[model samples]
Target chain A: MTNMNPSDKALVPFVSVDNMMKLVHHIGVEPMLRGLADYIEADFRRWELFDKTPRVASHSAEGVIELMPTSDGEVYGFKYVNGHPKNMKEGLQTVTAFGLLADVSNGYPVLLSEMTVLTALRTAATSAMVAKYLAPKGATTMAMIGNGAQSEFQSLAMKAICGVDSVRLYDVDPEATAKAALNLAGWGMNVVSCKTAEESMEGAQIITSCTADKQYATILTDNMIGAGVHINAIGGDCPGKTELHKDILARSDVFVEYPPQTRIEGEIQQMPQDFPVTEMWEVINGTAKGRTSNQQITLFDSVGFAIEDFSALRFVRDHIQNTEFFMDLDLLADPDEPRDLFGMLQRATQ
Target chain B: MTNMNPSDKALVPFVSVDNMMKLVHHIGVEPMLRGLADYIEADFRRWELFDKTPRVASHSAEGVIELMPTSDGEVYGFKYVNGHPKNMKEGLQTVTAFGLLADVSNGYPVLLSEMTVLTALRTAATSAMVAKYLAPKGATTMAMIGNGAQSEFQSLAMKAICGVDSVRLYDVDPEATAKAALNLAGWGMNVVSCKTAEESMEGAQIITSCTADKQYATILTDNMIGAGVHINAIGGDCPGKTELHKDILARSDVFVEYPPQTRIEGEIQQMPQDFPVTEMWEVINGTAKGRTSNQQITLFDSVGFAIEDFSALRFVRDHIQNTEFFMDLDLLADPDEPRDLFGMLQRATQ
Candidate 1:
């Protein structure tokens, strides 16, 4: 019943996981991460252009699922993501996500893509982006606490963006540390598996906490940190779930993605509501200082934000348009006369 | 990489729009509406069991898009919907939607279905459900103020659930009213096309206002509304949008799906913060009152809630299971070993 030609520009482009991986492989993960970081930084600089809201979350007995939606005046994007810590026991990833980007003018979805793998990449890219501005210059060593599915990306992105040359990894599970180290092999970085969280912090210029528990377990205490170290706190993203001790936050100049949201979901959730925190966008726009001195301690509270997904989706959509690795789904209905939606249904029956 | 057998009980069945329509045709719309009404009522009775949040909306210059998410302990559901009143000029539906139902235990989507048509159906069913409780017992005639794409569904659903025998229709566009009447020709209901809203409401026991305007246009005023008339105010949703006059809300005992949401989106938005309104579930569960007297005006302030879509998804999933019209989508990655997500990328290269 659609009158539009098959080559009409109104049709939406969809990218599945298989095609997304091809795009990553073609462009290389490091470059994709760098490009995504640039888009994110640009969007963050024009933060007033977005319509933002703290994500609406549904908490169950096992885990939580959330809908993170944001829009510029032109494009709207939302990510459906779930965090189930015990899912690994049931042979499932702790996090799975999918997202959509729609045209605000007509309110039609222009793109839909799997965001499971993309989230890992963007989270790492965001962490690395913060480190570029907040970390000590030429930081060569990083201590990775709770090395799991995310550890490899964090290590690689940090190395690519911040010139981190060595990673000391520690996890409650030795197998996870081995997996992280194995993934980093031949990447021209020294990987050391430490027995304790304290041991991992030794000689490290930056410390990244990526633990995956649903509770407030301090993976990094105040005593475990040293001066001039940038703490990329990635895993402590929900209320009652934190990896850094409160004293650690007290001693560091904390930077966050969105203060209203990060204060409720980031490690700062453990701190008072009036606790001091600077938004990372301020640092990116040069409105606020990032690393004032080489010996100063800084914390990047890495609770993911909607702008990051918006940037990643745009990047994927652009790359997919230039390539042929994506699939097109009949996601939107195209009627010869859109008012005759009923007629389209009747034709489908025939 | 999937190792699970086809007969695995852990499998989550999905029914797309094509399959869902086949199931609806097989069962017939009348019975399906009745079934969905039952499910919606059951959920509404136990509304306290749900985790409710006011929908997250992003409003642009042209239109508004919203994410409505809700969950019980077992199943989580959310719908992505948009309302662009001017979209019909651009050959697009005024409202388009899609939704997902996921298993809370594993955070995997069990069903993904198009909600454009289903939303129209469920919205009508929900209106009928509320009318059954709020309307006068022998209500036989409904004054449909706006004859748009949704008018036919509302007429049929009201006939099926509330024994509505006739509909008096009025629309700014007479062609839309003619279309509604033509679609309902065989539905065994008397259709009277009227020139004005005042003439349409004469002797009508139920008045349904489903007009599509993004401003505060008063489609119905207090002088036009009759005593004991159950007003199904459907279109006054989002900020700056209202169908009924503020005086009508002040006169009627308004009932809403969720108070926090209806406060911002429903007709109650015009009222004060402490303005008294009844939650529909409380009335359904017999904790609150509905139509205490025959002459008392009752208003169902329907901005549409997520739970109705959750029920609709559940209904479609259950009905489409025994049908063969669905396509299997490899949306979720099923790894032979869950920890081997990296292996999926490696295998894709080959």
Candidate 2:
């Protein structure tokens, strides 16, 4: 063993919330969203090369904490995320997250990052990327049904990736719609705050619904949808939570991230176990058809798979290479002699 | 949400390797080992109340990364550990780890700590704790078969928790034994360096076998162990790694932390599927027998479990209160008006 001091191998690159915000400003939010979309699209094309597993969740009375882990044969990534809807009323975030990426060859962590903001960016990017292939041709207007924490991100990602210029926002609470509208003011999008959900859907070719409720609440009904409109349903992510009506799901040709996970947590949880849903990776790789005709309705039922988080972490690990957007965290113990860890501790006194 | 500037709730207390070493010195190693033993014994007594699952592992050509998670209804804890035997050849640690503890009520992380040093402490403490109940009466000598990073900790923990006054060390490499013996010189124990494994067991009532190899190799054969001794086998902790001969296990009454995991990763892996084994928790809680006769041989088939790590994290979380040994990590994203996360990012630009 070499008698070296703690080296760079002992330090993990940690991206804090402040640094992550600075990174967003450094890259520009719209461009970063487009970048995440590109990375996510590339990973989706090689989905078969991933070791995929459903998230391991620990549920309690108030909320659930989950660990989502995935590996791409060379790199391993996992996200530690929690969902506590009751936290919102107590002035806390409903969802908070962080993530890590490690080298698969040596099993050492390479990056540790704050993933709450990144999760939002990646979720929105994934929605827009799927819509690029499944949405109606030249769809420029989207009816955003839930103007919550994820609404402004969805609006911006669509503007960057799918060339959408108009966003009609509606929320159950008017203040939420106003909040999203105020944030999107200077982002070069036509932000329209609507009083009712139906008014938000008027003349819109794409309808995106994202509502946060821990119940089986249908934010979108069957009669509200029109033909050839792509429905981006992102909020139905847990066992007892769904945003679209079953009739709406039965009519639309649905696409999902992973069938095993989406079948249990996505909008299709309300359907049978063997529900016919196309995997988005197959569609992105051209093995499956997407939006065959203008009259056919298509829906992207997203529950936020582990591969999206893996891609987002990959982007962060690459982008933070030569930037001052991260700090070296002394997270690993590197002893001078590998067999003398206790001696190293004893020497710490000197 | 309140317009607070990253309040304490958003910050997790992080203990780095330097801080962990300082903390070990601050509390003193022997006292800390005894303290950890107390926490682990307490948790094991209430083991049925915990949410236990086998560790999630990602295997590769050279190493493996594992996530061990458990919850005790009030707090949730998990450790991210990797074992890459090839790392030691490249002047790196064979094992490195970090862990987190979160509040079950809100799913917010409370503590984040470097667990490389802590895992060594807890594993040794666990072995000594098991020997305290299972070893023969007035047992004062221990034979340490593997003199690697864990040897000195095991010797010290036995001295602290089990009142072991002597330790005989042996290893395949003489340099490892010499290193352990040199570091353990002033620790108030009779440290003996032996040439062979048989000589290390001379007059010792406790035999601790810990060798780091990815394949099954019997460090202790059947005829080496005598009656009325406790065997702490901890190195055989993977699918193909084992340390003790099958005949030795067949003659001993095996005690295991978790049977399902031990059956796959412990010395009992070579035994039959329906091999009789007693849960250690039952022995600690007085529901089962331990060392009933002076001639009975008791073996602790210890493949480290999540509860022991949970106990160690709990010990750290409780002890680091009001101390300067930890730094605050801004790991969560808390926004004013929880639905206005985009507004928080927008305001950060100012």
Candidate 3:
């Protein structure tokens, strides 16, 4: 007789949508964002050790599906994400994602989690962590353009990780800005709802643009941007999409996630082929300079690389070690005898 | 109150291991293998319509994990598979896989199913499907070298799809050979267990070398393979792993699934960079020749491409419709308001 039962190693920890929200509230969202920033920064410091590649994308008429995979020789991770700009008209999120983490030693998935919310957290954390190094000293206010789903998370992450005291929200749609201001009402930061993008940039040392349009729309013109401000550009990630004017990209000292990817998908895609930009990891590793003078503009052009997702999955893996934040999913089949797969199926008949 | 409940679009259909075996029994395994062969053949005919790329792999000291992704401009699919030859030593399957099928329109995953067993069935079906075109006329017996987990599936697939009525099994370990022989006893095929690899090839027209060792082992020497026969070499799927000798590959008119991939992972990896081989799709589409002369040697050097996995997933997706083989998983977070993600989480707390 064979013990046709699944072992613990065969079971993967799965965090569903409900459990992800529970975990967020359990740890408090601010603390979780801060913790994720720490992990993202740690992974960035040792970025040379991890395997890196531009995300593989399958483009359709309506949207694009992408696989972002990376490994640190000990753990491997990949995120399945989709971007459908028209999804909002159909009452769906423009972007949704899920990720899995596996042990590199055996190639068995160890953690599976809904990354729609997690991606939001990690994206904001990555932006703020970069701002901490590139933003001007004594920067207290951030102009948050495009007050959509990511607006609140970006605000809180900046407040928790970058010591920002206030966020000025601006969106073409006033309802989106009102929604974000309402959501951030009791967060203790001076939340200012602005009428225009230029108004939002008033006296702000860090300007974060995260609008959700899939075309080359200049959300920030050359005249709107000033020197000494750190620009966190999050929207316009695909080939035909970008937020900043070409003049701004030419003048500012831009930093990117992965050059091969950011060259094709980030705002730099609008720039010339030989446009010079810095790799953020080099700055984190102290090989390159971040912000030399307050009069020089710095821009972090992010396209959501795989290492941030890997770090987020690693954070969830560590956080769920003792907490009841996930359920065991019988994802893999375990036969009593490894080579007896056929026999295992046959025994099930009896 | 804002509804925190997800919509129907957020639910992805999930098939578990137990359900996969049940579905196999429900549809009858032989018929499923034949159906999978049909789908594989159909996709191969339209090979130029697919978006093809070499699989993205993350390798470690122990094994490799890979993501095989493809799309037909309508439906998108990908398989997550891990090959750790050392797993069997610890009472685990050497390869375990799961796959996803998504609508290319919205980029939402429509199905997620366990593919550990499905992979074995599909790999065998693909081999036999190619042999149907390349094998000698009236070929009834196959020499199945390396009687590990994939042996029985290959035998059945060949018998069901390619009209092979008999199989001869040979392996370095007699216990593995005996296990496969016992499993195939009631499958209405002439199953022969041979002690030596050469004895298994006696009077056989199709030779399948599917040995499981990770290193290069010459399962079939130059003199062992007779002319006017078809060879399905499957196990040498990674770098530094091969089964057939270079001399055999040099003399044979080799056919490959995808040349870009086969050049690195197939038996042709033992050959030169400019080694001539026909793409199997060209043969199916009637653009190239296959098995023209009775005295000509033919080889199907299969390293398993993404299109085969795509076809298998398509077959499973079709079979699972209007059936109880799947359960809806809350995989994606869908809020009623597309941009009100924070509101959705805030309501979940209530």
* Per-candidate clashes, comma-separated: 0, 0, 0
lDDT of 2 at A284: 96
**Best by the lDDT measure:** 2
Per-residue alpha-carbon lDDT of candidate 3 for residues A232-335, written as tens digits (9 for 90 to 100): 99996998989999899988999999988999999999987789999999999999999999899999999999999999999999998888889887678777
True contacts kept of 2: 0.78
Stretches of model 2 off by over 4 angstroms after superposition: A1-5, B1-4
DockQ rank, highest first? 2, 3, 1
User: What's the CA RMSD for each of the models?
Assistant: 2.9, 1.7, 1.5
Compose the digit string of candidate 2's lDDT tens values, residues B99-162.
9999988888999999999999999999999999999989999999999999999999999998
Is model 3 an incorrect, acceptable, medium or high docking prediction? medium
lDDT of 3 at B61: 78
Which structure is stronger by DockQ: 2 or 3? Answer: 2
**Worst 10 contiguous positions by lDDT, candidate 1 chain A:** A1-10
Q: What is the lDDT of candidate 2?
A: 0.93
Give fnat for candidates 1, 2 and onward, in order. 0.32, 0.78, 0.73
Question: On residues B16-71, what C-alpha lDDT tens digit does candidate 1 reach at each position?
Answer: 44555566677777888888999999999889998787777888888889888888
Candidate 3 residue pairs in clash (backbone atoms < 3 Å): none
Alpha-carbon error at A346 in model 3, in Å?
2.2
